[model samples]
Target: MINMKRRTFLKGSVAAGAVGAAVSAGLLTPRVVLAAWPSAAFEAKSVDSALDALMGSHAVESSDKISIRAPDIAENGAVVPVSVTAPMSNIDTISIIAEKNAAPLTAAFKLGKGAEGYVSTRIKMGKTSNVIAVVKAGGKMYSASKEVKVTIGGCGG
Candidate 1:
């Protein structure tokens, strides 16, 4: 390995340390971090409230076209894998909701133009509840759900 001069090493370390300290102290935050987060929706206690806050209304049309892929029983509720597939064009947004969670609005994703109508991620669940997938497409809201039994609670159970 090429030896690094003491001066060079010290300079590199100082720069890294300075950047780290600035970030930790909230002094050098990038504007793009947590951009356009639906804070009110995420903080909503009830699923209906969350849906209303996030999607303007909870009234959705049940559709077989949307599919939610998840395990029937999640051994660890802390990191349950969930996948949503809405094989329809003009999809605008996809959201995942865990009905029993304190903050029932687990995750939401906005799809760009012509983007795939699919989203996959892990979400925490407090208990056994229905995992719902809501999709907004063509100025309409469609949804589907599947019950997920959590053997071990994830939200501080």
Candidate 2:
């Protein structure tokens, strides 16, 4: 009975130690696990410019496969829900950009095989602007956009 209990405790300790090490090493960081952040795209002035920087010059023409979801009229600019979904095989990434916002690009998502090419989050809008969604699939770039009207300032307009 004592040996069995000791063995169980040792197993638990080893597992806990491994988890702690992973977390400390940043292997379990939110950004790592979530695979978010491609800052260059979000900071670009226009959708084309951002996509050029992110997907490179080899990118092809935009397609309708990419979808941008957002309210046509945002009652409040502070927290406007936005979602991007690209229905394409071998989708490498998805990016969101707010055209009129000060920062422009909002978020980027890197996806793996079998991973869903979708992301939903709230982005602040300085005023009415076009929210763009760019998706990289099979070494090509596809994009879509929708205009969102903001009632109150969110990005400090």
Candidate 3:
């Protein structure tokens, strides 16, 4: 038989009940938990506009320090694997952009101080286009791009 203490069980029950009430009352939403959502950046229609909205500037330097790993040809454009690796220091953010998508900015990730500059995720490709990786480090923006061919369109061909 397992030993269970009455006081311990009551404490856990109260904690759980408090959490459940907070959630049910919509007090524990994503916006409240996480950082502020960048709606303008995500809603931008063009790649340049998205970059401008996110990074506060559209001009980005092309750099060899950033590497993009993605398939040259995607069989299903719906879920194409993409990864970005930047072995540079002071990486603030990493953003993925699909050149031909209606809203070019696919994903953006914020990194903490002293964090490794690596982000991997699957993104939807509207058609055959360039997959661009923009890295923000030390208040400067650097970018790298690779062409990806999509066999089946994902975003409303």
Q: For this target, which candidate reaches the highest lDDT against the unseen true structure?
A: 3
Candidate ranking under lDDT, highest first, comes to: 3, 1, 2
Off by over 4 Å in 3: 1-35, 153-157
TM-score ranking of the models: 3, 1, 2
TM-score of 3: 0.74
Q: Summarize candidate 1's per-residue lDDT along 33-144 as a digit string, tens digits.
A: 2356866567666666666666656779999988999999888988899999998789878999998776788988889876899999999988899999999888898999
Clashes of 2: 1
lDDT of each: 0.78, 0.69, 0.79
Per-residue error (Å), model 1, residue 8: 58
Residue 76 of model 1 has an lDDT of: 94
- What's the CA RMSD for each of the models? 14.7, 16.4, 16.0
> How much does candidate 1 score in TM-score?
0.73
lDDT of 2: 0.69
Query: lDDT tens string, model 3, 119-145?
Result: 999999988999999998888889999
lDDT of 2 by residue, 12-124 (tens): 55654554454446444432333345444444445544544455432446677778889999988888999988778888777788877655767777787689888899999
